[model samples]
Target: MNIEKLDLKSPDLVNENFEKLATLFPNCVTEGAEGKAIDFDLLKQELSHAVVEGNKERYRLEWPGKREAIVTANLPTTKTLRPVREDSVDFDNTENLYIEGDNLEVLKLLQESYLGKIKIIYIDPPYNTGKDFVYKDNFSKDAQEELIDSGQKDEYNQRLIANPETAGRYHSDWLSMMYPRLKLARNLLTDDGVIFISIDDNEVHHLRKVCDEILGEYNFVAQFIHKNNSNKNQANLVSVSCEYFLCYSRDLEVLNKEIWRIEKKGAKDIVKAFNQLKKQGLELDEVLDEIKDLYKRPKYAHLSRWNKIDEKGVFMDDNLSREGGAKDYTIINPDTGKPCPIPPRGWAKSKVELEKLREDNMIYFGDPSTPPRIKSYLTGEDLSVPDSFWYIDNSIDTRWQKQTFNSLIFENPKPLELIRLIMEMSSAKDSIILDFFSGSATSAHATFQLNTEDLGKRKFIQVQLPEFTNEKSEAYKAGYKNICEIGKERIRRAAKKIKEETKADIDYGFRVYRLDSSNMQDVYYKPQDYDQNNLDLFGDNVKSDRTADDLLAQVMLDWGLPLSLKIEQIDVSGKKVFKVAENSLYACFDSGIDEDFAKAIAQDEPLRIVFKDNGFKNDTAKTNVKQLLKQLSPETEMKVI
Candidate 1:
């Protein structure tokens, strides 16, 4: 539950025990194959297939030259121990998370435990400008192959080739990097989920297309163009002064119908206008005005009708929605008129339903001598419909970005104020948020801040690549080490601010997970050439970098796995190995599956097997795994975890 108890200390972790751990993977000893047997044709096809455009709720994934499935299948659904107050990586009450690694892998890692639970996701991914900002990643590359696969020498570990502007395939490269990431991000959202993506002209058009392809364009909510530049140079043919924020709903209409809260001002304006009309000497022994102008709100307009009030501040009252909410008269039911024809707009409550209102003496008939109204305490106020545009001066980014970019002192930032509105509109106070690019963790910041402000407990899951943060910048000059540094710092600052302002109403902390090698140990291969030092280093109990799947697998292990299980292996990312424990146990060792023969013999279940990305080979045949398991005859339970 705590760090000492569960082992999450800090960033020092990567440097401390990691290198020593990489030597333990089952395939590590294979000496790192570098052939690039990846089915380039298939990879291309998948990229072109547009999962978003295709609106794939779920799909069968299969990729070659990599074992993405293996890694994903085994990813953790729950941490072995929660990052409790003692184990907490950031704030004590925080439910936000920061993860470092390829977002695709990170998403796979999160699939099981967090599926369909996240409420919002906001990201600013690399546009894949020809200069590559993203590293081409692969899990199948063994140690030896990793060097070549990365196109680098041992001199630089974190450095990756930036997409140069000259590449003819700039768009392709960026899309390739984003394709899987966006696909995975979509899965993390709850049914009423929503995602906000920030992009520039570089890929805004493409991003929109992709959203249409994946989430269904109908789910597209709005594209807000925010001024991102003031033309420092101002010498170009056209100064592209603004960037775009693309939004999509998991199910837009439904989310919108149930989600967006009304803005306070709008609510008050409505009431104020009604009161004004009453004061204007309109003939009225009536209650609940059937004003037509009330419903005529303009799209994209920030204005609202002013409602009326006398002393206790501005107020507006509209029927909670129904038939006949309009026509009315009298507060005491006018000669026992018994609630004035049930309110034209239809009461939010039914007559029988509102019987309690009568008992509570809360319902008022009306005041011709006064303006009819409903009373709502500001403290108990749910937000009104939030404006779609998220205004920011870049003094900050959302909480996620705040932490992510804090070191850079990048002047402007989008406050969680914006994200909070979106989330509130989605009606998920404690929902999860996902940010693949996770710039400075602004989204994360917003989630935490909103939680504290509203006494809501929204959660967030942010995925950021260990993209290099230039050490020469203002942030680095301030002693910031990397982009993640900026990210973590933002959270710390945001937490402090929230506590200062809101009196610490909710958790403002976060759990941090980084993508790395798998935790599973592969039995040692042939001993190296006889050398005393080599032998000492090669001592048996080796540890590997924890993979996305490894994290997931560990989470399941921590949750307790039943021994009896059935195993099903899907070849989605790699060998999306599913371990089923009757109708219960399900594990996916999809991110690192290759030695399929041994694992097939090792288990049983009430089992289901699943993998990450795409696991199996094209027509590779699963009967082999099924028949092999039965023939081995060793049984308890089997399934995908």
Candidate 2:
């Protein structure tokens, strides 16, 4: 009989790293004082040319708890994600996910399944201001128990204020809280994926250095300045209306060094005008006059500068010469019949490119003394590249967020337009976007909103720690006990509003999973500690309090199948059976399972099958079942717990 390892937890990363290194350089891998340790002296010799040794002043970011934080990241947790079906929206059919838990442990739990799979991760972590809060890192303590004792087991108050400026381990504590989470988050990113972290002045500098070390300094994308607030409060020495988003790519080279941009809202009217004129069967000149009338509107004043119109639509003239790296080129103006005067920095386009543009009628030569310029069309993929600095006016700031909730449920909630812009630039249709620090679920709302606009099927995973709301706060009075409540309700309200307003067929649903202790019982583990006589007293190995659905969820977690997949229950001759993701896995948790049931299930040619150890009436029945499965479905992997 095979006794499967019953403990479900994150893998031991240190040994995994050693094994990977051993695979790469087997000669350098030798048995040491400790079992299966890397021979560093030999490894350094093998990589002699590239190794950097000693305390020889190399650039690095360090904090007191850095090593401990790394250990915490590498340390495995036996926690599992427990599905809360009652809290979910369209539980079985949705691709969206809402995980309520400590993000550190949650990140570890997701590492194996989601490794190198996510397309975008946008997190708005605590800025580490004295007023802000960070999770109290206590890996040894039972997090669930602590939450229960603190009256937060339902979804509240696991966060503690890490008020810096007075505490000895002020910065170190905050760094410790963020370091491991960031490391595990990087593991979840695809090769070309990108991460955006929001921070304020308090921790932006420190956060940058930490991200540089973890994500690599070369992968650094940009530190985008967001004008988050519209009203200027003369509260401090300098008006602090801006926040920053530090972006980094998993692999810049693989991204093709190219990123998409969001279409400017100011250009929507121009597109509408073009469509209207086209419907009227107007010629290019006739359309120009109508479009010119549109440009006269005060709201469309920005389009006034883009006056030139042709079959290519509205365009603005751009100087041939670039700012710094301009090339010299000669362009004979057709009107003057002579080479146009070159600008101070020479031409922006090369000779061949200039000739091509000229032939394509993209250049204008209206005057003799004036330098010729390229006509940049204002239609088609005329998306605006996000500037290093940007402003989101109050009008676009959480209109739906507040209108749906009918109250201000979250303080300083990120504007939906802001995250919509981020997702548009970084994600493709069907991309998975993860936001670990999903305060008020703005990212989730934005993902839904954008999908409706473009008809793209982008999914999202939102993780929040259930930080409690203040007793006197508006959110608390409005019936939101914690941040998770606010977050989930926001998505529900936002989805309803979007559906009612746009009539778009969008998947604005999500499955809810909460972090909890593993479903396996104490007897399953420490079997060696207990005698067979005493072990029998516990009866079944699985926890008595756990239901069949709980066991199935644990199995899904172990198999790395997404929790959002459809599940169906069927009966096989008085035994209950569960099928996950159609053919991906089949499981039976009912007792009295027999060879007949196994043979019946094997007929479907399932990829994997699992059973409870005591589910069979006898050992002979279990043995016969295995043989039957092997004969019928030789490729099926059978496991018992």
Most TM-score-accurate candidate: 2
TM-score of each model, paired residue for residue: 0.54, 0.78
Clashing residue pairs for model 2: 157-468
Number of clashes recorded per candidate = 165, 1
Kindly list the per-residue Cα lDDT of model 1 for residues 292-318, writing each as its tens digit.
Answer: 344344321233232333333333454
How displaced is residue 127 in candidate 1, in Å?
3.7
Top lDDT model: 2
Model 2, range 1-641, lDDT digits (tens) per residue?
Answer: 99888678888998789879989999875443233457677687688787656445557766566788889899998888888888889876888999998898888888877889899999999887776677666555576766654344343335455455555556777888899999999999999899999988889998999999999999999999887555434675777788899999999888766667877655867877887887789988888888788766544555577877777678888777876635455878888778878777777888889889989999977577978888977764577776666566545555654666666668787777789989988899888999999988989999998999899999999999887789999899999888889888888878888899899997978999888777877544574678766756567777667788778877887887766667888877778888878878899988887877887898788898999988897999999999999999999999987
Candidate 1 off by > 4 Å = 1-94, 128-132, 138-159, 227-237, 252-257, 262-301, 304-390, 395-408, 411-415, 524-553, 557-641
